[model samples]
Target: MTTQKIAVLGPGSWGTALSQVLNDNGHEIRLWGHMQAQIDEINNNHTNSHYFKDIVLDEKIEATTDLKEALDGVDAVLFVVPTKVTRLVAKQVAETLDHKVVVMHASKGLEPETHERLSTILEEEIPADLRSEIVVVSGPSHAEETIVRDLTLITAASKDEETAKYVQGLFSNHYFRLYTNKDIIGVETAGALKNIIAVGAGALHGLGYGDNAKAAIIARGLAEITRLGVKMGANPLTYSGLSGVGDLIVTGTSIHSRNWRAGDALGRGEKLEDIEANMGMVIEGISTTKVAYELAQELNVYMPITQAIYSVIYEGKDIKEAILSTMTGQLKTEDEF
Candidate 1:
């Protein structure tokens, strides 16, 4: 296999884990981040202690604080930054790139202000002449497990089938696999919306709710996600795939999910500001809840679960009250959109 030079623009948990995957696939990787100390740690110690405390990164995975140096002569760029900073980083990437390369983003969340997907932000910031069709890689995979080389499967969605296939080959290994999908909208929507449900699930768990309640949240949450995604031009079946129900289940149930953790804290009476300050990571669901709530209203989609979570986080509503209201809302059929 020919070794490809790839730049991973983010040294956060996901970025660091994916750099290992590319390194394992015999690729030269330049892991970029804004933190100078983190870069030093990855280069000298071969570990990002801030994100992954126990795992040692591969020695070949070079870490850099310089964007231009990271982008120089790379075949593709994988962005794993948080949604809040995607546009800023992508703009920097656009200014630094000297040649065209396949651009892929693994970040999941709609832009808080614009309610736009990360790929859209990338396309707007990174000129068409400087990159190929944007690819979105998302699914049930979590960085905590992925960093340890656990078995994982995810989707690579793009408008261009060849590009999706290219990404599939680039990241696949014995433990890490990629499936190609053409429905970029569904893949991205599912990826972003699931985090909100995960938050709700965690809140349910924290509020002393049992398995049945969590299960209800997951099921109804998928219905809500599917409703909005379909309204946004996503394929309904995509919700049944890895990026949809699969991701929702793992994230909503797992302890490793930042969104879940945040919701748990909120359910336990912690303030949103306190949760954000202490987590040391971006809980994409918090911002996503606001965006999804607004978008659902604008699109005239019924998403009671999303509204409940949004009320708790944004409106300062009591978690128990918000959840209770959603549960006792007007009667409807299970299949109602």
Candidate 2:
């Protein structure tokens, strides 16, 4: 493979680990972070204390706070910032990189209120000529596990098969595996929407439910995802791939998931303000819940789990009440519509 200059625009755990993986594979990586402390640590100390602590960064992995420095001379860019800041960061970076650079984003969430997917948001912020070059990297891998070089898998989806293959080659390593998927819409949607269901699963676990309930919810929750995804131009089978069921399993079951942890706190009767303050990490499920609820409303899609979680989080409803309301509302055959 040709050596390429790769720029990653986030300094969080996932971003740092992914940058490290690319650096390990002999690619030149330019990592961008908003915090001076993170930039200083990466450049001066070869470490990111705030994210991947104790993991020594490769010399090929250069860190920068300046957007231009990160974008300059980069053949491709990874937009790994949080969902809320995706558009803002994309707009700033677009100003420096030309339209030919392949822009890939790992952030997974629909735009709240607008209900637009992250790819749509990226396209809106960047020039129209570069829209088709956008790519999304998603799957079940957690950043913490990835930093340790554990075996991991993810999907690279793009409008062009060649672009997807290129990103796959760039990211695949000894412990990191990449699969190519052409259904970008379904992959992105499943990746975003699964977080909402994960919140529900965590809330159920917090309420003392066992594995049986969690398994049932995950199954039904995926049905909801598949229904909406197909309606939005995604292939139904894509949701069965790494970006779909794979992501849902990890996010819903792992304690490392910010959304699941946040939902657990909420289930225990904690306020959003207090929970967020204590966690200090982006609970993407919060933002995704807003977008998922809005999309459900606009599309008239029946997302009971998403609706229940949204009620508890944004509508000030009691978690127990929401759970009961869903459970006791109706009963039907297992496969009945």
Candidate 3:
């Protein structure tokens, strides 16, 4: 593979971890963050104090607040910004990016108002001809575990197979495994919608439901994702792969998931606003729930689990009532949909 300078926009935990991997592989890295504090900590202290707190960073990663400076001389860009912030961040990056840079995103979830995927936003933000370089890397990776050097597998999906391989090569490490696929739509959709299901599973867990309940919800949730993904021209098998079932299993079961934690609070009788206010960080599931709910309605898709969580979060319906409604109001075969 050809060597290239990598620019990672967004200094959050996932971005920091990915930048660390690339830096460790001897690639020059330029890191960017909207917050001066994040930029300063990465540049001066060689650590992301706010995000990857306890984890030290590589010396080769140079942090900057200037988007132009970060993109300068860089061959590829990894966008790790929040889903809601994707459009704004991509616009800034595109303004100064003169050369065609292979773009990769680690963000999951959709824009609530638009119900658009991250890649869809990228297409609108970047010039049309340049969008073939857009790649999506997603799977069961938890940034917390990645920072601690835990083994994780992720998929690099793109219309351009060569670009996918380029990103795969950069991210592959002792503990990080990378795979490439052409199913960008399926992978991206699964990555976003899985968060909504994770929230539902977390609510079940927080309500003291056992493994059987979690397992059932998770399996059913995968069905919902597959139904929508297949209808949208995504490969059916992609939903059965790491970016789909693997991600759902990990995020739905792991406590490290912020989305799941937010749902836990809700399951324990806390309000959505209260949980979100206390968490500080983005609870992607909240926004994802809204987007998935709206998309399902528009597409005429059946997403019971997503709808249940959406009702609890948006319609002010009681969590217990939502759960009971789902449990008692269904009696169809698995293949009915």
Instruction: Locate the minimum summed-lDDT window of 10 residues in model 3.
Output: 126-135
lDDT of each: 0.94, 0.86, 0.87
Model 2's TM-score against the true structure:
0.96
Q: Per-residue lDDT tens digits of candidate 1, residues 1-337?
A: 5899999998999998999999999999999988899999999999899888899988999999889999999999999999989999999999999999999999999998899999999999999999999999999999999988899999999999999999999999999999999999999999999999999988988888899998999999999999999999999999999999999999999999999998888888888899999999999999999999999999999999999998888888899999989978999999998
lDDT of 3 at 169: 90
Best by lDDT: 1
Model 1 misplaced stretches (Cα beyond 4 Å): none
Query: Which sections of candidate 2 miss by over 4 Å?
Result: 128-132
Alpha-carbon shift of residue 272 in model 2 (angstroms): 1.4
- lDDT of each residue in 1-337, candidate 2, tens digit only: 8889988999888899999889888899999988888788888888877666578877667888889888887888898888888888878866776656888999888877678888888888888665446789999989989988999999999888999999999999889999998888998999999998888888888888889989988898898888788878999889888999999999998898988888777877788999999987888888888887888788888778888988988899989999888788778666543
- 1 or 2, which is superior by TM-score? 1
TM-score of each: 0.99, 0.96, 0.97
* Superposed model 3: Cα runs more than 4 Å off: 128-132
Lowest-sum lDDT 10-residue window in model 1: 200-209
lDDT of 1: 0.94
Q: Tell me model 3's lDDT, rounded to 2 decimals.
A: 0.87
